[model samples]
Target: MVPAPGPRTGARPRRRAGGRGRGRLADGHAAVLQERPCWGSLEDDALFALFRKTEPKVQEIAPGHDPLGDLGPRGQCRIQGLDDDRVQWQVEFAVHQLDGLRGQDDGRWPNEFLSPAMVPLGGGLNGMVSENRAWVALPPSCLGRPGEFDGPTVVDASVGNKDVELGGERGERDRTALARAVVRVANGTLRQLGCKDSLADPGKLPPVSRTTPTQMDALCGIKGLKAPDAERESLRRTRVTSGQGGPVRTCDLTHSGRPWSTSVRFMTVEDPQLAKIFSMAAMTGGPRIKGTKGYGTLTPSRAVYERTCRTGRAVFLVEQRQSDRGYTLPRELLPAYAESEAGRLGCGPVEMKMPAGS
Candidate 1:
């Protein structure tokens, strides 16, 4: 594919116009498709064929621009029933530059979507990180529900730090097929942008169930964490989940239910770029975790710790939850959590101690 003119310079005009097709569904939903060639010949017969292969017709919408200047250019479409044309799902496609231009440096894709915070789609092939980009397919309904294996609900493919994400709420029956189509589109988008094809082929994805609640004692075992008060004792619990056997991990503490409340959230990030972003946030101010080879800062709302592990650089975070609290933030909790997580990664010991009562 030839390189197109940059957004700074005038972008090339629309090369072709797609048919404004409409669809109607039995659910009494109707939709209109507005298609404008956002990327010249990149929209080929194969792409059109993929759209037609689905039962519901895809109504293409005009390309969209990001006012925030983070996502450079975008296009969107929605699926609707052929007869009634009621909208059932929406899909988005976008591309950004890699050199941090147009706010590409933001870590939304790398930090949240591609991190362990989100569960893998299936077979672990749908989620991966390479030197150039991080690609993952996630369940759009809820990351907390690991058992939901309809298909790849969300596909995020970022190359050289820039990203192209296809997200939508899809029906259970058609999800797997639609997800493969999205993968093909995403791969095509990457090629059009002159990036390598980093996304793998979406083969038969199996029903995946990875994330699970960790034992409550996971946090209570921390040296400095105080026992929950009698009134809130039963309410205190810990839930843990991680990426599909990847380096990303999360630990959340919450009140069981007596007025559902959140205490603190801990995360370990192995993505190099994301680690850098958190490292920058933690170094701006706040006290460091004593005896740790890494750096950390504690704020009223959160704490961030960065250190090198056996694999590479990693960042750990401890954040206060917005929900009603049932426990206090012990000073030693940060280091204790960090040490425990580091050990899980086979990192050397981190002897941490808070200075005498502040």
Candidate 2:
């Protein structure tokens, strides 16, 4: 992006967001590319303008999280509670070429919920193995709310790149074909989710997740899911009872015949069974078991219990997008589905990794 011999000829090329190459807005030329932040409570455009006008007290290159694979620039903006306070937006830009048009847009998105509660999302633009010349932009975060991304879901978005080649009709047809193909892919994918008000002001939650489902993703009747034979983990059984002694065990698999350190200790009780205990139990407390760190209900969640009780044919649901031991879960659980009852839940059911009948 060197200036062609003039007063601004010494202009240095700025490194693009992806570090793929370089770019520079020509001296004295106003930028026509448009982009806005989506994850915060305030309007990003105006906030960003005010942000740059004021200097940030803390401005440093934030390092990426190696354990989580989230390298800093996630487009999460934190605007301080002051008038002159700036917003730190973890924004990433996508740079590409299209005929005479070039712009930049990346999807480091925002959320209605905090981390851990926020459904995970991600994608990549691998130039090496893409197999197609047309590069499509995918959002880096889920557009749905806290519980929205829990079920099978689909994700899609696109934007213009920032490098417009002025060369004469070079690869115009090829580029045109690529653009059309990208549009087709986007249309096909979105259409599968039925009609949605994508252009409407998506405020805090998504325009799509307008309705929440009743049958949420919850833990089902306890079933054994085993690890790989190579792991050599053995199954064990022990007697357990509720506070006042209700048969909390579902056969030998009240929790799992095959051991699994689940985030929470879960058991599905029939409404009839729960109804009896309903009269005997206290106003606001579940059975408590005292033990070491490996105690009962490793991670207790009342929300998980409510969802489980509401559904039939017990399914061990994982509200999170993915499991810690990926190999223990099924591949179908990772995909995005349209907004069905299961889809709206944002997460999928966990298929016990153990033998089918075990």
Candidate 3:
């Protein structure tokens, strides 16, 4: 049977002399319990117990795979369920501390997880954030499929200033199932921690529609940015998602079923220190985009720019590789893309200037 983490609201599981438990040992020799205290006032131990009741079949699936371990901020713990010695499903959980409200914006969680490849999980991403904390659920990278993204697998819920990220992986089921499961755990954790902002009912969450890149404005969530007919020549499918109708947007494009080749992401960095870093990079790291409020730097791999929007400082990134045969390169479309998005975001006009010939 899968070992329980501990009794709800009670003592944490203890580690034996040479076994897995709350503290770590020195190479199986020393018994000095080196345990990192769980930061923040939230009761994470109680929150984990909810996992036992939240998903009962886990023990039945992989009785040998214990899901108990303490790795918050210092490490992570994973639970796996297998069928005939093969991993059928798995869940990984970890917590990270936030620096004095750093990355405390509404888009913090989404922006951290949003990527060019996070588009195929069907329903996109579901999440909620408040003044003190945040939480999000989305697809996790498949274990068997290696390098492919599919199952909506992870939930990142913050308690106080620390982030509690939980990821789920499934072999045969669809993304929605995992999404629901993770969301349940996330919501349960929030309630256990007495967090005020709980996510909406997971059952009501809708699946994302796989559509062609026909509507530019809708695809990227930026108004007036029309899709270029030529750009669609290589497009096979695209997933566009907005988390809880927030300003953060993600658009990933791919030709094959998995491993999206091209991606467009926009996020507003609310933390002043974070924004200042981007601003400094815009001024010193590379040549300034002529018509925008930020700077532009292009390598063979990715093209990115940052601008000052009415909301604060915003970042726009277009990552693509020529081998992917996905979308046009940095020089071909990034300038126009940045301009359109900047305008929609209520930022000043920007013009990108490529360095001297070639």
Candidate 4:
């Protein structure tokens, strides 16, 4: 009874010019094309084809909502309109990385998608924060049994003083390894999602995008540093220290075969999660913090001073590299992700706490 579906065109079906269904002309008589029933035996086919075409367009335009009625009309958009090829490629790459498809032979489409999306996705803050926390909490199962860090080792120093050593060959190696691991996980995850052009040789990928100094200041939650006022003056005095009794010191240390003058310090915190987050943030953002020949030599000057002054315990022999640019996890978000084993572990409103006495 019903006619066969309309001829299958290679191109998907699209919406009618005016709106749903064909339009009639202004004349008293229906348009010539009106005889061609908009709802015909092939109507279902046409509608399906139209859906195929329009859905993608909708997704491209708005990525926060469903294109089809199946997902319901949330009034939000669900498409991403990626115009720039570079950005498109980067998004693909980052997507591939997140999909866990690194080192796979299935091309690199996932990686390409993810690479560009990083910028628009809050400068990879979401991913970076998530991954760093994961590393601190879970580490890698392949790392083998945990060894007891009694003392005289970098890990030991890190655990004991809650400080990190970011100098020498070992430090560079550890950082490179961690970075590579992150990249691998990101790429590998994306590969599983059918991205073909994501991975194109590590050397070819763009250099790790650097966050602007302004962005860093924003993340630090410091307001009006550039403004002139008594608060600003007080901040200036608090941040700077002079010859004999300055709060910060620039000391030379070798990192990744290069010498760097890094500022080091110690921060006392009660929460272990906060401590882990601070360590991971510093290692990933500030500088490499492992594989150093003299890692054991690092120490926290303030902690030692405090212990000596308060408890009269002469524990000042340990010297470690601590940085001024460390963070403490916000107390508020702790409850939200406390139950999550591997995702979204509570971190919010991170505070830049001063080391002992700023």
Best by lDDT: 1
On the 0 to 100 scale, the lDDT of residue 270 in model 3 is 29
Cα-lDDT of candidate 1: 0.43
Candidates in order have lDDT scores of 0.43, 0.21, 0.39, 0.20
| 3 or 4, greater by lDDT | 3
lDDT over C-alpha atoms for residue 233 of model 1 = 42
Q: Which candidate comes out best when scored by TM-score?
A: 1
lDDT tens digits, residue span 280-301, model 2: 1111233422222101111222
Between candidates 3 and 4, which one is better according to TM-score? 3
Q: Which stretches of candidate 4 lie over 4 Å from their true place?
A: 1-165, 200-227, 232-358
TM-score of each: 0.58, 0.20, 0.50, 0.19
Clashes of each: 14, 21, 13, 67
RMSD list, candidates in order: 10.4, 22.0, 13.5, 22.3
Q: State the lDDT of candidate 4 residue by residue for 92-189, as single tens digits.
A: 11110111112121112111111111111112212211111111111222222332211000000001111223335544333333333333433333
How well does candidate 3 score on lDDT at residue 218?
Answer: 43
Taking all chains together, the TM-score of candidate 1 against the true structure is: 0.58
- lDDT against true structure, model 2: 0.21
Minimum summed lDDT over a 10-residue window in model 4 is located at: 150-159
lDDT of 3 by residue, 305-351 (tens): 76667765666656554343544455555666677766766675776
